[model samples]
Target chain A: MASPPTPLRAPEHQVAGHQAAEGRLGPLVDGAGLFFKPLQGDGRGDDEVSFYTLLSSLPSSSLPSSSFFPSFHGTRLLPASDGSGPHPHLALEDLVAEFSNPAIVDIKIGSRTWYPQASEDYIRKCFEKDQRTTSASLGFRISGIQIRDGSGAWKPDRGEIRRFSPRDVRIALRRFVSSDPRSDPDRALAAAVYGGADGVLAKLGELKRWFEEQTLFHFNSVSVLVVYERDAGATLGKGKVKVKLVDFAHVVEGKGVIDHNFLGGLCSLIRFISDVLTGLDENCI
Target chain B: MASPPTPLRAPEHQVAGHQAAEGRLGPLVDGAGLFFKPLQGDGRGDDEVSFYTLLSSLPSSSLPSSSFFPSFHGTRLLPASDGSGPHPHLALEDLVAEFSNPAIVDIKIGSRTWYPQASEDYIRKCFEKDQRTTSASLGFRISGIQIRDGSGAWKPDRGEIRRFSPRDVRIALRRFVSSDPRSDPDRALAAAVYGGADGVLAKLGELKRWFEEQTLFHFNSVSVLVVYERDAGATLGKGKVKVKLVDFAHVVEGKGVIDHNFLGGLCSLIRFISDVLTGLDENCI
Candidate 1:
C-alpha cells in the first residue's frame, strides 16, 4: 500500500510545547492515556478524535487480555470542551502499580508519519530482511516513561521519555538478555509478547489477524509495552510478564491507504520481532 | 491439628429447606454469587457470616490473576439490606463467557465437618501415602456449581451441582489429557494450576504461603475450580487453562483446628491432583 502524505499539522516543537501547557497536570504524553475521543471540535485534530471513538466502542470483554496495552480505565471530561476551557482526560491503570517488582520496556513499532522518509525506509527494509541468515536491527524504536510504583511513588525507568531506534532496541534487548543468563530471556520475552505457546510466531500472526479484523486505520505508530517483575521466582511464570499495545492517535477506519498500510506495516513489524525472539542464535539479530 | 468437632448446625435437609425459602430469587446456593456476608439475625449462621466478611475484605489486587476462581467483580448490596430484605452479593466475571470454547470443572477439595470418621480416616491415609506408589483416592469430594455465562445467561454444565470424588477427577483429567497428544497434558495442567512454572510442588507451596499470609481462617470446604478453553488451537497454549479457589461459607479468624485442618487437607488434595497430572505412569498414581 502506498503511504499517505503526512497530513498538515503543527511542527513537533510547537505541538509539544502546546501540549505541555495544556496537560500540565497530566502525564508527559498528551492523550496517551486516552481510551475515548473527546467530542468533535474539542481542539484535538479530526484523526485523533475518530480514532478514540472507534477504540472506545470496542467491548472490553471481547478483547483478549494482554499486557501489550494498559487496561484502559474509562474517560472523564474535565470542566472544558462543552464550554470553552473544559477537556476530556483518560485515566489509565498504572502499569508499575500492578507488579511486585516491575521492569517495563516500551518499544514503538511501525513507521511514523512524522519521521523523515529515509528513517521510515530504513525501518521497512529491516522488517523485510531475512532472520535465519542475517543479524540485523529489527528497526523498531524504544521509549521510556515514568509510572507510579505500588507505593504510589513515581519512578522513571531507564528508557522512559525518548524513542530508541531499532539499533537501540537490539542493544537494549541484548543487555537485558545478557544481564541474567538464568532468566532464559528470549523465552521470557516471547511468552510476554505472545503468551506461553510453543509456536510464538504463529500466535503472533493470529494476534495480528485480530488487529486487522478491527478495520482500524493506523496513522500514528504503535507502541509495544512489555512489563516483567524482577522477582527471582517470577522469571518463569506465565503471568509475570506482559506485553501490551498502546497509542491510537493516528487510527481511523476505511478502505484507504492508511488502513491498508497500517495492517501491512504492523504485520511486517510483528513478524520481524517474532523472528528475533525465536531464533536461538543471540548474535543472529 | 486435631479435627475440630463439627460446629452444631441444622441438618442438611432443614438447612437446604431454609436456604430455599430465603433465596427465592437467587440461585440454589443462597450466597452462590455473594461477595459480602448477609447481615446477622437474617438467617445465615455465624460461620457463614464471618466467612463472607473475611473474603470481602480481601483486596482484589493482591490476588494473582488466576483462572481457578472466577474473576471478581465488585460487591453490590441490593435493596432491603439497609433495613429491608435485600442482600449483598458478589458479582464475578464468568469464565466460560470469557473464552471461545470454555469448559469448567469445579472440584470441591477439602473435608467437610459432616464427613464420617471412617471417610476422614481414609482421606488421612491417602494423604500419607506416597504419590509415586499409591493409586488410592485422595478421599476428598468435588461438587459442581452453576455460574453465569458470557451471554448473561445461567447455564448448568453436565456436572454442575453434582459432586465428584478423587476417582471422578482422575477420570475426567485423564480424558482431557489423553484427547490431545501434542500438548503434554500433565505440564499444561500444572501451568493452569500454578501459572506455568517448573516444580509444581514448589509453586503450590508458595501459593499456600500466600494463603496463610492473609491471616484469614478457612473453615468452609475449599473448592478448586479449573477452567479450560477447548479451542482446537488452545490444546497447546499455556494460558488456556485456569484454576481457582472458591466457597468461603465457613471461614473464620484466629489459629484454630478448623483452619489448620483446612490447610492440611487442601495441601494433601493438591498433592494428589499434582501427582496425577505430572506422573503420567498411570499405575504410579
Candidate 2:
C-alpha cells in the first residue's frame, strides 16, 4: 500500500487558550481508563471543519493547547490549505496515494485493523491491556487462515478489520436467519466466524433477540463465551442469551459474536449510554 | 443425605445492629448487607460461613452496606446471580430425595457434580450475568449427553448459588482439579459436587497439585473447564471443547457443560492455579 498523506490537526496554541477559559471535569477516562478519539468528517478543502470535529470529540470543557501534539496537527492530521508546521507539506498526489494505501491501515491476522500498523509487539500489548481501549486504538482482528481458494495457491485469509463507527458495529451483529447475501451477513458470518456450528449460533441469536424484544428491561440470562481463533490465537468472544423458556432448568441459546457485547443494564446507565451507545471512544479488548 | 440439621444461623437482630458498625462504607441496605454469625469462639456453634465470607470479601470501604448483597461489588455486573438473593434456596437433603435417595451430588456425568434439584433458572442467571460482567461465566455450563446417569436419572445442577468470598469463588472453580480425597465430603462427592468431564474428577488432584506452586499472580492464565448438568432442554453446552478440538470450523455436537475459553491470559491462570492450589471457592460461577 502507498504511504499516507501529511495528516491535519488543530493548532496546539489555539486549543491551550480555550482550556484557560473553561475548566474540564473529572478524569475524562473511566475507572480503568485509557487515552481516547472521534470519527473524522469528509476530508475536503475545509480543514477547519475537520479540525473542529476532532476537537469536539475530545473530553474537555475547554479547547486543548492549540498544539494538539508537540509539532503536528493542522499540517498533518487534516492537512491545512497553507503549509505551516513540520514535514514538507504533502502534495495532492501524496494525499491521494496515502488515502488509497492499505499500508495506511495495517491489518493484523484475524482481520484486525491498525491505523499506522499493528506489529506483533503491538498485538502483545493489547493482550496485556485486557480491555477495549487498546482494541479501539487498533481495529478489529481478522484471522489470517491458510486457505486454498479457487486457485490452488496458498493465501492469507482476506477478511478485513476496519475501524468502524459504533453504528457499524451494531449493524454487523444484527441479522436474518437464512443464507441471504447482503440482507444479513451476521448469520452467514456466524458460520464462517465460528466455523460451522449449526445450532449453537442459531439458538444464541433467537434467544438474545427475544429477551431484547420481550421480557422488557435488561435480560434475565446472558452467556459470553471467549473462544480464541485456533490458528492465529486471536482472542474472540461468543455471547448467548439463555432465557428461562419455561421451568427453572430449561433455557435457549442465542447468537454469537467475535466482538461480543452490549446488553441490558450491564453497566451504570450513565457509563453505558455515554461510552457504549455513543462511539466516543473505540470499544476494544 | 437425610435432612441435615438446618444449619444454624445467627439471630437477625444481633447481626443487623453489628452490620453497619463493621466499617463497611457503601450505601447500607439495613436488611440488605449485614449477616448473622454466632461468634466463632462464643460456643453458640454455627457453620454458616458462606454468607459472611461472601460479605467480608467486598472492598472494605463498601463492606458495611455491601454484605447484604454479597454479590454486588457494583462494578461491571453480568446479568443476575443464580442464588445471591431472592432466588429459592435448596438443601442437600432435598437434592438427595430428588435424586432417588442416592446422594445426588454423587451422580456423575462426564466428570461433574450436579444437584438436579437445583434450579436451571438459577444456573442460567449465573451464566448470563457472568458474561455481562466479565464474560467467563459460561465456564459453568455442563454437557447434555450425560446429564442423566447410566440408567438415565436427572441431576440437580446447583447445590447452592449463594455468593461466595473471592477466596471461596476461586477455590470452587479450582475444586477437585486435584486434591487429596481426605475425608472432606466436598472431595468425595464425585460428580455430585464438581461436574466435569466424567472421569476428569478422578484426575482433579493432579491438575491442581501441579499448578498450585506456580500460580503466583493474575497473569498465570490458568483455568479449569468442568462440565455441568442442565435441564431436559435440547442443550446445556456439553462436550463443546472436545467437539471444537475435532475441527475448529466444525460446530460442537452434544449436550451439557463445556469450556470454550482462550488459554492465553486469565483463562490460563485459572487452570494453572487450580492445578496447583487449594482452599478456593466451591460455587464460583
Across the candidates, what are chain A's individual TM-scores? Answer: 0.55, 0.18
Clashes of each: 27, 111
Which 10 successive residues of model 1 chain B have the least lDDT summed? Answer: B8-17
Off by over 4 Å in 1: A1-25, A28-42, A45-50, A58-73, A77-87, A114-139, A145-165, A177-195, A198-203, A233-236, A256-258, A279-285, B1-285
What TM-score would every model get versus the actual structure? 0.33, 0.22
DockQ in order: 0.01, 0.02
TM-score of 2: 0.22
| Residue A134 shift from truth in candidate 2, angstroms | 19
C-alpha RMSD for every candidate: 26.2, 22.7
| Tens digits of per-residue lDDT for model 2, A109-193 | 1111111123457545543432232122111221121211122322222222133332433332222111332443324323333
Best candidate (score: lDDT): 1
lDDT of 2 by residue, B1-285 (tens): 121123323222211112223332111222323222212222211222332243346455532211112122212111112222221111211111112112111111111111122257754564344433223322222211112333443322232322333233343333422222112324433333334552333344333232122211111111233333322332323321111000011112111111112211122233323332332323222
Error of 2 at B259 (Å): 8.8
